[model samples]
Every structure is written in structure tokens, then in C-alpha cells.
Target: MNQASSTTTSGSAAGMHPREFVAFIAALMAVNALGVDLMLPALADMGAQLGVATANHRQWIITAYMLGFGSGQLVYGPLADRFGRKPILLATLAGFVAASVFAAGSQTFAALLGARVLQGLMSASTRVLAVAIVRDRFHGRQMARTLSVAQMIFFLVPIMAPTLGQLLLNTLGPWRFIFYALAAFAAFVLAWSSLRLVETLAIERRGSLSIAALGSAYRLTLTNRFSAGYAIAAAMTFGGIIAFVSSAQQIFVEEFGMGDRFTYLFAACAFAMGVASFANSRLVERLGTRLISQAAVLALIALSVGHIAVILLGVESLVSYMLFQALSMTCIGLCGSNFGAMAMEPVGHIAGTASSIQGFITSVGAVIVGSLIGQSYNGTTLPLAIGYLGIGIAVLGVVLVVEEGRLFHARQAP
Candidate 1:
């Protein structure tokens, strides 16, 4: 096995042996997803069994974790750049594992939320580091291609994680068991990562991590109109996913009357979306992220409009709304990976910090944004669709700013 790390590889890189690199990146991307997805099946029951009354509070379980995850990225990114990716990563995993144990043993929903918050706070390192790894290993189209492939596999979590959580819920007879499983999974990753990983960030390459870097990272990203546009564009799009994460279980089991079948149904929707994203990764380079995103944003808007229309038109069946929502999610498959790559392209000097900022906005800001959108649920899909339409317009506008032209009329992305 070649343990030699090459920093010179290009897109679809040959002689680079993409398999291990791919696995490593995918694993990194998926770490945070595990905490998010695995706990989904347990959301409803966890609320009830853990003494959470007023279903609205239950949504916070997901939102609070994301909130912490977002906040923690600011610290992790600089630490990785200033210290080293591996050390920061291992330390974060330790926090995640310990928090998971706390969550599993918690006596109440509030206690469980505290643990989830801690778990998410630490796990934030993995998310930022995953993107930083891309910066470390490749650049330009090569980086995009690598990220797309890695993201494709990374997406499989949404596809199977809920179902797996449901299986644990049924066999183990309580929702807390899911955290036990999470602890085990995090522990395994921590062990494997410690043994196999090398320092991706060169020690001498780091700049001062003073508050100045964070401010500078933000300034550079925002001042570069193209990068800012892309970053905001990615945030607008992925915020929808965050909205869904906070509310899908509630919508399925409570609003839609799906009962325990929520997990199975949730998994089905996630798989459909994941498949679309996997396909997008393959075609993005050829299609161009700008063109592809334009199409996706347009399609997502159509789906959102159609959803509201279908509901107002008396199409109240679960399958009716589910199909439209599922269709809408296909757009997510396209937006998340490409938008992410585009955003990170320009901030190479502070790639780790840029990643943290990106994750911070997407996860932290998204939680606040997504929570507001999720809380507006009025026994209909309008709130969700309305959320999508608003975000879609914002995403479209950001793309316009990024491309420096009207939608579809931009001859080339700026």
C-alpha cells in the first residue's frame, strides 16, 4: 500500500490511487451526518419517552446540535491550520464519543439535548477537516471532481442512516440505544483515523490564528464577489436540507400520519435525493457547476410552487405531497456538492478557515433559518415549500451575483 501522499494530483487524477483518498474523505464528510441521520428515527419517540411535551421543543434536539456544530467550526478550522488537522480531529472525536455516551444515558430530553450539543460541538471538526482535506490534496477541477465523488459516497448516510436507526429503535426497544450505536461508530472512526491519518496541513504553511484570520477569511471570501456569491448560494440551497433535518421526522410521523413507518419513508426520500446527488457529481464538471445549479435552482422552484399548488388544489394524500417533496430534494443532490466546491475554490490560503466559515453559515445559520422555516408548519406543506421558494430565490439571486448576470443569460460564471 502506498502511504506516500502526493499533493500534486489533478482531477480524475491518475497514479494517485483515488480509492483510499476517496474513502478517507467520504468518511470525514459522513461523520457529522451519522449524528444527524442516526438520531432521526428516534426524534418523535425520544421526545415522548424523554418527557418532551409540546412537539415544537423536540425540533430543538436537531437544531441545537447543528447550532453547536456551526459554532465549533470557527475554532476547529483555525486550530487545524495553526496546530494540525490530525490532532484537532482526534480530539474532537473524543469529545463526540464521550458526548454520545452522555446522550445515551441521559434521563430526560433536555439532558439528551445537552449531550447532543456537545457531540455536535466537537464533531464540527470532522466536517471542516473533510473539506480542508480536499484543499490539501487537489485544486481546481481536480478538487471539484474529488469532492463530488467523495460527496456522492458521503451522501449515502441520508439514504440508510434513518433506516438503520429505526432498526436499532425496534430491536433495542428505546431511542437512547441509537446514541449507543453512535458512540460505537464514532469510536471506531476515531481509532481508525488515529492509526491511518497523516498531517494534511503543512506546519510551516499556517498563518497567525488571531481573530484577524477569522475576520480576514470572512473578508477575503466576501470581498471576492464570485466566492461570496457561491458561498451564499451554497448556504441558501443547503439550508433547505437543514430545514428538513429538523422537521422531517415530525412531518412524517406527526403531520403526515405515517406512524412508525416514518423511518422507512424518510429513508426512501433520502435515498432518492442521494442518488440524484451521486449522479450530479458525475455530470457536474461536464455540465459546469453554474449551468447545473441554474437548472437545479429552477427545478427546485418549480417543485416548491407545484407543492403549494397541489395542496391548495385538494391533493391531500401523503403520496401526493411526498412525491413533490421527493422531487424537490433531487435539486439538493445537485446544489450541496457543487456549491460547496465553488465556494471553497477562491480561499485557498485559508482553506481550513474558509471551510469552517462555510460550515458555520450552513450549519449554524441554517439552524436558525431552518428552524424558523420548520416552526411555521401548519399541518400543510406550504411552510416547507414556502421555505424552499424563498431560499430558492435567494439562491438564484446569489448565483446571479456570482455569475454577474441574470439566470441562464450568464454566458460564463465569473
Candidate 2:
């Protein structure tokens, strides 16, 4: 291994401790969340400012970003594997910053949508390379624990981003300033990464930049039963979460009548997710990913079914809805990192390509599912509830297939 790669694999990068390493990568990954969540508060204002007529058309902003994000991952994964993590990350961060600036200055809906797409394209590197970097340093249950910790930190962004965006929209007097703030934040992250982040992919381990090599790497990632099955299961679960995110503002503000309190309520649910992730980080080594994830999925399915029943029976108070949503978010937190770690466990040799393909599948699937769920809003929570239950059951089926009908069988932790 090269000196830079060796340093990262030694457990610290650029003299940073493990906790700081986790925080750094978490911040990078949170960029994607911020790009999506922070805009929720400003969506109405942005749509108005950009001359959008239909309420549902505003969702195209998010869908466009997701489409670009998913497609861009395919390009970055092989490049990261061919080049190095740090360089690819730095380059993408720079592009992300530029795209944010363009988005801030966009005068039309079309221009803004284009900018969002470019921003998502650049942000894809943060997701792909961060996972690749983690895989470079850890494997198996250790990777799961590390990812849980990172996700725990990442949930903080979603918890506060809407509130921050709302404050900016109210105080700054325009929605464009939110994009400007994103640009500034990206610039800061870029500077921090450039100064501190070290290369994780060793030169000797770098894949070739040939089409044949890329094709083989992708084939290896897709053909592995464990990896493919877990990836699909993860994608389905993620679809449920994305659907909630996309519809959250409408559900909380319009259906439940939370109005201005929506941000706090959303943050509260996100805090539940954060707490779950932290607990998963602590317990994954002992309980194993399969047991924890399977239990969580089953719980999610039950919660979704019960919530839907409550809605149908006319007992769906705001309190009850929040309660169910919080528990569901917690379940998602438990499943997410575990599924990711299990999917990547057997595919570590092609970590970048594997991470890319997995992310592409999950992001695209989530976007389509989320769009369908979000657009189905009829001033009621039934669509979201049904989405959750349906996706959760699908995820469970995929997991069962991955484990060959086994649900909670514990394997030795690596």
C-alpha cells in the first residue's frame, strides 16, 4: 500500500482520531441530506418564485436531483477506484460548490432544476467515496458499527436543516439565499476535506480505467448473490424513508395541521432515528446485523399496518401519527447501516464499484417510490402509510431470500 493509503488503513487519517474520521465522513455524506431536506421548508416559496403552477410539480425539483444523483454514482465509483478517494472527492466537492452557486442565482424553474441536477451529480461522490473509504478501513460488523456511528452523526443534519432553512427563508427574504447558504457550506466542507482527508485507495489496488475493467467490476458487484440481494432489500427500505421525506412537509403541515411546528416535529422524529443509529452502533457487534435488521423491518411492517388501521378507523390523531412515524424512523435507522454493511461485506475487493452500484440502485428506486408516494397525497396519510407497509414487507422478502429463508441467524462478527 502507498503511504497515504497505509495511513488511512491504520485507523486514522491525517492524524485525525477515529471519532473525527467518523464525523468528517458523516459531514460529507450529510451534504446529500442537506441538499434534499434543507429545501423542504423553501419548496413553496421556490415554486412561487419560479412560477410553478401545480403543487405536485414542485416535487420535480427533488426528483431531478435524485435522478442525477443516482446516475452520477455510476461514473464516480470507477473513477474513485481508478484514481484515489481524496482527489475524486475534492474534485466533486468543487463541482458541488459551483453547482450550488449556480442554483442560488438561477432565475427560472428550468435553470434551477438544471442546477439541482448538477449539484446532485457532484454530491454523488460524497456518498460513493465515503462508503468506499469506510470499506477501505473496516469490514464486516466493524464496518456496520462504524457506518452506524457515521449515520448517527449524519442524522443531525436532517434534524436541523429544515429549521435552519425556514429561518433563512424568513429572515433572508428569499429562497435563493438557502442555495447560497448551501454553497457556503459546501465551500467549507471542501476546504476541510482538502486540508485533512488522506487518500484511502492504494495505488497498487487501484483498478484500471478501461471499459473492460469497469464492466468486470460492475459485473462482479451485480452477480454476487449476497451483495445483490442485500442491496435490493436495502433499496426497498430506503424507498420507504425517502417517501416519508418527500411527503413529510405536506403530511405534517397540511394533513395534521402542524403548520410552523412541522420543523420541530420532523426534527423530533429524526432524533429518534439518530438515537436508534447510536444504539445500533453499540449493539451491532453483539446482536449482529441480520438479527437487528430483521427485527427492525418486522417492527416497521407492524407499525405501518397499525398506523394505516388507525387512519381508517378515524382515530389518527396528530399524536398517534407522530408516535407511529417516530417508531418507523427508528426502525429504518436500525436497518439502514446494517443492510449497507452486509451488502458490501462480500464485495470489498471492488468497494468503489460496489458502493456506486448499490447507491445507484437504492437512490433511483427510492426516488421513484418516493415520488409515487409523495404525489399520492390527497390531504390524507393513507398513501404514506400504505407505502411504508408495502415496502417494508417487500424488504423482508428480499432479506429472506438473501439469507435463504433464515431471518435471525447470527454469524460470527468479523
Candidate 3:
């Protein structure tokens, strides 16, 4: 889902060029993000509809997916590396669509949770394949540019997701319809992919797949402080954002009374993220990955402290809070792309395993903690603000550990 080769495979959409192919690949990867984003607005509604009273339980829908998504990648990436990207992708898409349909028909909380887990498992294939494909075809600035373009397109999900969710909620009924819509979307993408997607992994380039092979990649990635540190930093930073994401709808709609309008603010932040992502795409090549990512992390830490201070000072206004959050998200946009590339840069041969390891640690492992922090949302911004504060310090610590350098005076940043 990341890259389509003009030379290796059957070129683009018959007559389309390489750029178009990359865009299509990005779209495929971005759909997984959409699946996560589109569900935010509907979380509380779904929870209550499913007889889930405790706020914490509602997060299982998301956490379970991430867990499955993280763990599933371990197998998918290695298998794709050994086999071909196209076949693996189609199988995952088919599974994802089936899971989504089952999810739509879920009559119990457990049933829905299971479906979401399956959904995550299936979608993990797309994510790793996308990154690997990108790695296969492009490197450095070209990869960054492709990711930015894809992210720019992907940003539309946050912009449109809530409205779409709201429409389905009101027009069709409860949350099941949302899953139905997702199933339909998956079907559409799977169909399109079946005809258009290509295998980017060259046959000669295919590596042997064994537990030992994965172990070797894992050991190298984990021992290399530079890659390990940045990867962990990326995970912690993303953990902070996921903290908000896993809870924002419940806090705004259920606690603050925003209702379906919750999506608008979410979209607003997402749009800012898009702006910053596009800006990063342009500047990353010029400034280099380390500097951009470091700067963004600095901005995030600064804002996190500022946000907590403002809230604790008794000046609790929703407008001011949202403003700061949107600003932080802009920083998030600036940071996330580069962090991923930086973390995965060193592990070239086992890109799939590297990707899986990266995904598991940051998204899978960290999101669990993030979701718990979100579940601690207690009718105020305090918990959310405090969560950011903790995550900020944690991410900085990871940066320090990864670099094995001083905090304010680390000579070698990356």
C-alpha cells in the first residue's frame, strides 16, 4: 500500500505515471487511519448502545484493534517479504472487509470488540506493505515527498470523518451503520486494488523468512541506539496524540456536551496537522529529518507544559484549550512523518520486520497506555492536560535514552 513501481510492476493505472501510483498506494495506507478516525465521534454512542457504562470499556474497541494491528504485522511483514506484496495485500483487504461486515452486525459489546480486533489485524497488512513499498521505490526526500502527499490526502479523513459519522448516526441509526460504511469502503478499495495494485518487492530481492531472520532484524534495531531512541520517541509522541484521540469524543460530546459537533473541532486540529505535514514535506529535505523532528518534539513539550499551566491556573476556557491543542497537533503533523523515516532508516534489508517492530512498539505497545490515560478522562481537561504533561516528559526521556546524550545539550541529536 506504500509504493507502486513503474518499471517492476505493470506501471500505473494503465496510463497513469509513477506519481499517480504512489498516490494510490498512499490512499490505501491512509484508509487504515480513516478507519480509526471515523470511529472517534461515534465511540460514546456506540458504548452506550452496546450497554457499556464504564468509559474505560469503550476504549477496547480501539485498543483491541491496535493490539491486533500491532501483533498481526509481525507475521504479515515477514510473509510479504518472502512472498509478494500484492497477494498479501488482497488477502488482508478481503479479511478486513469481512471483519467490518461482521462488526456492523454485532449485537454485543464483545462481538463488536472482536470485530474491531479483526479489522485491525487485517488493516495492519496495508500499513506495513505501504511503508515497505515506499522504502522499496524511494528513499530520503522522494520517500518524504510521497509520504507528505499521501498525508495531505489522508488529512481529509479528520476533516470529513465526524460529519460522515454524524450523518450516519442520524440518518441510519446507531453505530452499526458506521461499521457498515467502513465495510463498504473496504470493499471498494479491495476491488480497486485487485485490479490496480502491484507487487513492489523484487523476486531476487526477496529475503528468507524465519524466526531467526526476524530475530536478527529485531536485535539490530533494538541495539542501535540511534534508531531505537528515535523510534521510541516517535512512539511516545504518538502516544500523547492517541491519548487525546481515544478520549476526545467522549470528553467533548459526552462530558462537554458537544455531541456530533465534536467532529468539527477534531477536523480543525486535523486540518492544522495537514498544513504542517505539507510544510514538513517541503522543508524536511532542506533542513534534514533530525532537525525537523527535534524541533517538533521541542514544540510539543513546550506546549504541553503551557497547556497544563493554563488549566491549573484556574483559567479554564474551552476555546483557549482547543486553540493550544490545535497548535500542538500542528507540531504533531510536523514531527510524525520524519520520526517514522528516521526510526526505520537503518534497517534496510528487513524493512518489513523493521516496520512491524516499529509499529508494535509505538502504536501497539504505547497506545495501550495512551488509551488508559484517555479512559481516565474525568469530566475535565485536567486529566487530558496532565496526560500530555506526562507523555511530554516521557518522550523527551526516550529521546535522551536513544541518543545517549544530554537533555538540553545533546551534541548529536540523531
TM-score (C-alpha) between model 3 and the true structure: 0.91
Tens-place lDDT digits, model 1, residues 88-109? 8898898888999999899977
lDDT of each model, Cα atoms only? Answer: 0.78, 0.87, 0.75
The alpha-carbon deviation from the true structure for residue 41 of candidate 3, after best TM-score superposition, in angstroms, is 2.9
Cα RMSD, each candidate: 3.4, 2.2, 3.4
Clashes of each: 1, 0, 2
lDDT of each residue in 378-399, candidate 3, tens digit only = 8778887777667667776777
Worst 10 residues of 1 by lDDT: 1-10
- In model 2, the clashing pairs are none
Error of 1 at 154 (Å): 2.0
Candidate 2 vs 3: which has more lDDT: 2
Model 3 Cα shift for residue 390 (angstroms): 2.2
TM-score of each: 0.92, 0.96, 0.91
Best by TM-score: 2
In model 3, the worst 10-residue window by lDDT is 6-15
